[model samples]
Target: MNVRFEKLYEETKAAVMRYVSAHCYSITDIDDLFQDTYLAVYKSMQSLTEPIQSSEAYVIGVAKKVLARHYSAVRRLRAQIDVSLDRRSGRGLAEETADSVDVEKLAGDRELLDEIFELVTVMPVTVQRAFYMHYVLEMSFAEVGNELDLSEAAVRQRVARALTEIRRLYKRREQL
Candidate 1:
């Protein structure tokens, strides 16, 4: 209801919607992400220390957080389902060979992966997709770039920047 918020929304909503839509996998997710993005932006606006320099960037940042949260939840749910299915199917030779795995190490790795996923969502939309397609989806830079309408060099740059940012965030967390 704030006048400033209305102005910010009017200025940035399309950009925010585009950012969310680009990252989402399905039409249903697009609507959910778009609405959640605004909700996050509204909540974040209340905690601002000063007037934002770029409303579009601020809204995009909030959208990134919202998207991160959504992905984390989905990953957790998927993992849970996998575990349950594995239990139902019983242990195969490969699964049985995992008995030597250290629970603590697995836990630590999961935590690190979650942190990396969080950092990925902090990047710009293009960079995020570039990183996801190139790494997670195992697409080559040229393929990813072609799909995204970017040059191969541009895709490489975005993926590199995304990794650098993730490493920076990881190091920052380590120091904390």
Candidate 2:
């Protein structure tokens, strides 16, 4: 590894481990996320044009993407499991199931939370990083701005835009 990447790893490895551990339920999952996060950083490190103001924040951003992709794949796998179980039981419970047994009930409002995450994922990378740092990780806007090389006001705007998009997505999904 180059000196810069080595320095980044040494500086941010603990924070990355903590991030993965906090976000995942299992040790295996944490390991997987950690590996994936480092891989992402390694691949993208070359493309970073400017000096990194906050290596911790940048690595955390990569970790968040790894987690999101992991969760999305897990959700798909769970849906497949549900389908397989229903088929194996050889009983059609679809019609008799209560209307309340949708994604909301299964996840206790987590469906909406996942929707917000999905919306955030589609945002520009910088904006997504700012929003995640400020909201999900509870970093101050000033901290996020410093990390992302943006003004605090710019971070605030990114967060506001992300929120607006999430609200719009929620409303549109509700209508459907």
Candidate 3:
């Protein structure tokens, strides 16, 4: 360590530590942030062009940058985690619409289930297979395509067409 940096550290370490401690919530985070602050200060000290007039303020500025970076990274990671969870939970547009209907409430109605099956059975064989593979078996479009030797787009088209037809049939039955 440079003699100048050692002197600067001795002078401003306490203030930097207090700043980091007050901003950070966890002890581990505090320790990490404190280390990062000092490491940044050390690097800045190495590239000295002019003598820093106020070591305390300079150290505090470094700590603030470290804190900002830490918070930004945490926010980015949380957003990525939320996106992963939504994908895993099957919360895409079609799935969200399906979820709006209370399937559990209708589960005991055998006649309704039969009518749904009849509507599904009316779909073309490929459409029926696509719908079953994608929704019933929880397979992705790519997986369904691989299994049936169809393109993913073709599989998606089949499933979407089936859903639209089924929704129409369901509404007609409800009108009756």
| Reference-based lDDT, each prediction | 0.65, 0.68, 0.66
Residue clash pairs of candidate 1 = none
Instruction: Give the clashing pairs for model 3.
Output: none
* Tens digits of per-residue lDDT for model 3, 1-176: 58888898899876676566445533235568878898999998888799899989999999999989876876547634222232223213232224245556567868767756655555555665666556655678997787667899998988886676555434443444
Better of 1 and 2 by lDDT: 2
TM-score of candidate 1 against the unseen true structure: 0.44
**Which regions of candidate 1 deviate over 4 angstroms?**
73-147, 150-176
Candidate 2 global lDDT: 0.68
Ranking by lDDT: 2, 3, 1
Question: Estimated TM-score per prediction?
Answer: 0.44, 0.43, 0.42
Candidate 3: C-alpha lDDT: 0.66
Top model number, TM-score: 1
lDDT of 2 by residue, 33-64 (tens): 88999999988988888888999999999999
List, residue by residue over 1-176, the lDDT tens digit for candidate 1: 49988999999876765566557643235568878888877887888879899889888888888888877976647634222233223212222222333445445666667766655554465776666666655678897777778899988888776665555544444434
Q: Go through the candidates in order and give the C-alpha RMSD of each one to the true structure.
A: 15.8, 12.8, 20.5
User: In candidate 2, how many Å is residue 67 off?
Assistant: 15
